[model samples]
Target: MKWRTLENTAKIFPATSGKKDERVFRFACVLKEGIRAELLQEALNKTLEEFPMFLCVLRKGLFWNYLEESKLRPIVREEYRTPCSAIYVRDQKNLLFEVTYYKTRINFETYHALTDGTGALNFLKMLVYQYLMLAYPEYVKGPVSKLGITSSTEEDMVEDGFSKYYGSGEIKEEIPRFKSYQFPYHRREHGRMKLIEGLVSSEKLLQKAREHNTTVTVLLTSVYLCAIAKDMSIRQKKKPVSLMIPVNLRNIFPSDSMRNFFGWIDIGYDFATRSNELEDVIAYTSDFFKRELTLKRIGARMDNLIQFEKNPLIRIVPLELKYIFMQLGAKFISVGENTAVFSNIGKINLPDDCESYLDYFEFYTTTPTMELCMCTFQEHMTLSFTSAFVTNRVEENFFSILKELNLDVRMIVSGDSRAGQEHFPDLSKETATHDFWYRLFTFSCLAVMVISNILNYLLIPEMFWSRYVMGGMASAWIITSVGYRKRRNLLKNAVWQLVLIGIGLYLWDYATGFYGWSLNIGLPCLILSCLAAITAIIIFFRLNSADYMIYMMITCLAGFLPLILNIAGIVQFKALAVICAGISFLTLAALCLFQWPAVKNELIKKFHV
Candidate 1:
């Protein structure tokens, strides 16, 4: 089958997919009756024929990962896992999406690299519409006039709206960049993302937005910023609380592309500069919407992106190199800006007959921090929050504002046995156990530093910093133990711990005066120790040697740094560098000789050379 490169916006997703952010989203439809596996499978098979773009697998190309049509069909089974799990393209060769049913819910989980929420929702609506039609032919006997249920030509469904809108002669103006504030929260836990959803009265929310003279998106953004401001520490109040709002371009641009076609706008408020009142936030967000969310501004942003992509030098770079740079760019963009993301898919309108069988729809997107996905069906508008943090203070504050506005809200926890409608609980008291442990560990580290410093002052007057260095080493051990206990991934946890220890030891050695020990002995020893540990892990565990190829390459790469420093005359340590280099080269040679085929295949897959 012919292959197609990912959309311009879709290119970053594959590189950004990780445990913290899987770059996946879920659009689930709740049916009034129980789901039938056979009917769902049949419906999926039929739907793929109409939406052939979704029937493809991700494949590595020289310059990028492309999609090729797959011969294998998707299986419709019971939903046994959490929502929005990682979908490794290389492992699941046939499909980029999964169709699973749990009781009355039919979930369509898709990787964001393949399609956006708009595309995924369209496909899901068709799948469910087809299933309902097949199960009860009498119900959908009339004309099939629904947007997604009706057939669409391949040309229209697979059109690249970005290319269509790209203009060569467009003036490239520098748009103002905003450095938004980030929340002062701990790093994400080592497992799946947490999901919390609430169903509210759509009419009430709309009325409230109308009263404030703003749209739903602006109102929600304002409320979210207010929530963050309420939960922020006094020191954090000095910065702006920003929210990233994704805007679908299909509405503005003329295109029938079901693929990714969207842009994002950052709306923020600096509590230090502006008042923390709700009215001020809403007014500020409304003004931003008026200025930045216009066609001219958005079109200019799109043109600049397209122009950069069309650059001659960037276009010729190999895919492997591009992937590395893209990963770094993605991380920079995510962490450098925005506190949270609020994606409003707007109200979903279904046919009168199909509406009766469907209960409500919930949407969620994976995020490194907190994300809110909003959609409305009938009278219910659902806001789903997917977060990495265990604290729910922001969520509590958000809903509390709505309650004060006299909007009736219903809460639903994903894994909670109390599935039905219930009042919103006090999330302040609902803390995860990990939160407690993290606080305790942080406090203990502080205590250790203080006591050690006092002891060093009394006993070792000349080396006052010695005890603090020891305390730092003790803290590294504690952090590594906690990480290992939570993730159970020995290789990842151990490598990070080793990195921390190396950094601490080097700093201590430097503090005692310019000593060659850190570079000549300490550094080489750390590199050699890593090599030994990784080798033992592969052999004793009887694991696929190919799986550790990247790790092995990284160790060899680190070993080369010392040699480079010595060559530059910065480090006068020839013997240590020579020893480390010899060991690294020998390990690489052994792997190449014994596992040549595996190493070759892995390199080809990763580098796409």
Candidate 2:
């Protein structure tokens, strides 16, 4: 398989993304009519031809992660799961982007490692254009012909713009080290997000920006900072309300690459030292944008970023260790300094011919804190805020500021775009039922334990059998917990159960008496049974060798422990131990002979450091 290196900016995503922040973004184009799934698939097929780089999958290397060409293809489906849900599995070969539709909206969601918002918007535009042409050929012959739209060459689409524009210069990057204030509100359930999309008139927002003598981004960022300040206490106000604004590098560096070609600047306003007036905030934001958004400053930042990636010692570090350091950098350094993210995807322009067929464009990204994404189409600008917090106090305060300015702000709640309902599934009913049953079962368990202790005190008065019952319940809880946590990977769950059950059985034997039965008979039997069961599972499921080899090796190593114990004179019985040892040795030797390459690679990845 052919592979390519990831850009410097793209390397951090895999390490930092989790259930809370998926590092995924969505671009949706709502048309006047409902979306036809078949026609949308056809359009996606045509669009993928022009953007082949998006077809690759992220892979692990010795020292870094890379993208490898994948044979898997994307298919358009009706939107079922939440938007911006995880698309990249660590070792799975799946597409980095997905096209899903709901009602009249055509949603294009992409993993940040594949492309940034600007690059994804280009792909969505092409897809919408193609779908329109296929759906209405007559309109294409009329209005579409008047506009000129052509696909860029594939070579340009896959170009690494960072490498192309990186200059050999001394880096003098300075980042403020002060900690920013984070929202104290509790987060929603995992994989659940609250989206507050404010649709307003572009003309009115522009006029307001003009009155402030600032650009729309600076003005809106000012409003966002002020909104966050509304909920801050006097003590919290000491920290600055900082916003990380992403800038399109293609505009300044001149590249047609669809890969990640963007940079960000941090702008903040300290309410403690400066005036809290809106005008003051706008002026501060505008001044910071001017100073930090220049070509020289951005290039220096980019050079600094690239220099770290190019370091000899850093390059030699294993990918697994790199993930730890990068994850720490993202948590303490990247996330610690920013209060929120405000990404301006800027204005989205479609052909005038097809503009009437579209309602507007919407953009939003998953974030660990609050993020305000702005996109304009025709006369409408969609300001989308996706937050991890359960409360929308900051988002509500944001629109309240806009409403105070006399700007028309309407909530986009039509069709499936309603907050908490559009992206997340309605699980309240099911959750209620599950919670009721759980509570009932827990109460029953407590009642049973109390009854057993009372009966033991009345009848036996000295046996204390209830203690063994408590031990049994504890063992069952541990086993069930492992099963629930590792449900996604049955092989891993089986391995855990095998190890945990062995320990539990030995402890039970020790409590009964210091007998050698657990070591000589019970443990050997459990290991033998686990080996047989896992082998049958692999055959039945046709699992990949890479997925099960490590677990199998672990079980085989455990199988030898029984014979070792017998040889140490700890086991009175020896027949079962000898059988387990012989089978384990054969199993291990067969794995080395048949699946040597996978075993070798797995070992290297685990112990590379």
Candidate 3:
């Protein structure tokens, strides 16, 4: 019954734009009269305190670990931290966060490695709406003050508590991850324009889409492709329009978990002919994309992931050694890593009651390097836009074109005279600093996991046994507390895991003959761990075991391998035993910590659905 926290053992791939490890994009909106930071912050504090998973930070050590959900976890709290001082809020605002409050003007930049534009922007809109509604509950049902923007999606109330579309069964599908190389993609065109956000009446938006014979996805993507074609002056390239689309995995997976659950789905096309109107482009783009995205393709990708993770060698590598392999693995799975990714989270589902309180919302996209990051989120009618560019001119050029198309939109540049300028300069510097920190952080963590694995070999026999008891005891926290997450509740299960771990560690410590431990104790540890993992997985995940056990086993062996190698001089370290113990802590203890929950209703609704 012991379980570890879900924070440790989780590896968050840093966001990247080209080779850079960090980049952020932000957009801002002024609220209707009467909304202030204090009111919004209080609302967010209450909401997030109820959902603690949103507060986690990256845990620093040798291996990848997440912070325990703690008081310091992020909230509507403003960190007057030097440079970009702002509030950090959660779930009710984004795909990642439903919403939280920020200054009237905000930059929504996050490392591209964390998630694509589609997820980030949805987060922004939700955050803004949540802030306004919480602060001004009486604004209800209309545009407010000088902004002329009205409550579009849900500027009003609380979530319906769960998805209205639940139980439709129309949502499930399989996605292939871990598979070997698919066709590597190449950009079809060259020129690039910043993605522009515009407001269109819901009726007009739909009508325009109908006339063009395209869904919003195809229309926007086609616009992007055209911009690229123009920029690169891509003449005579065969049918060359392509985009990386992020597919949400919630519908694919049986669980209704509202956490980070999604996969990348690719959509691309070559033109039948070059001469085409916007309408023609839309029709061609729409029709081509429909059949290409299917459940079969997703399942194939999932199979690919299994192939990679289940490989005996991969499974055997310890947590410390995963980086070397992961880097190699990442390159193998990419599809023209340069072809721009366009993610559309579509319209966010806001609370119906929220209209009485909120202002409109915005979605923004960012990356270290890309022709553009196109993101869109719909409130009742208009889609707010947040775009990133290699240069300012690109962004300005995009706006010019949209105006030519007669689309009415407002532009709020970061350093405008609007007084919110206080937030930008600092945020910019912070973004730059983070760019360096994130990459170094990843590389450092990998190095630590590797070193810790090496240290496990030089341990004292008695000390080794004690450490395993301590680590196992620490690891059993969540498995027991899940039913009643409290310190006292965890004590019972922690005791059991501790005893079992102590016995397992002791058996291997002195099995008499050197090979005897492998045959007797090591073998049993291997067997029991496998059984324990598999049964829990099947019972919990409700799907075929997805090579998780294989990896866990591999991590343990990998941790041990350094010590064996050090003895043979393949590696050299004085504390090989200590490093080996570290591996046990990371593999068993760290991973257990990762098995906690992110969403409340996801569990409730999942069981009912």
TM-score of each: 0.69, 0.77, 0.52
Candidate 3, residues 352-408, lDDT tens digits: the string is 544444344444443323433333323433333322333333345444554555655
Task: Evaluate residue 522 in candidate 3 and report its C-alpha lDDT on the 0 to 100 scale.
Answer: 47
- The best candidate by lDDT is 2
Which residue pairs does candidate 2 place in steric collision? none
Q: How many clashes (backbone N, Cα, C below 3 Å) per candidate?
A: 0, 0, 84
- Could you tell me which 10 consecutive residues in candidate 3 have the lowest summed lDDT? 1-10
| RMSD for each of the candidates | 9.6, 5.2, 14.3
Per-residue lDDT tens digits of candidate 2, residues 220-337? Answer: 9999999999999999998988888888998788778888999887777889899889999998888888888778888887888887888889989988899999988887676668
Say which prediction, candidate 1 or candidate 2, comes out ahead on TM-score: 2
Each candidate: what lDDT? 0.77, 0.82, 0.41
For candidate 3, give the lDDT.
0.41
Compared with the true structure, model 2 gives a TM-score of 0.77
For residues 1-609, write the lDDT of model 1, one tens digit per residue: 445667888877877688888888989998889889999999898788778888777866556676766666789988755578777544335578899887788999998878888889888888888888888888864344565444557888788888888762234655655576676666555645777788998988999999998888888888899988898877887767878889998878876778898987777688988988888888988898888877777788788887777787887788768878888887776475788899999988777877889989989877888898999999989999888876777888888998988888788664221122331122334335756776676677677777787888898888767565665657565665556453534555456655766676677687668586877778888888988887788788675554477568668778776788788887797988888988888888887898787777656555532
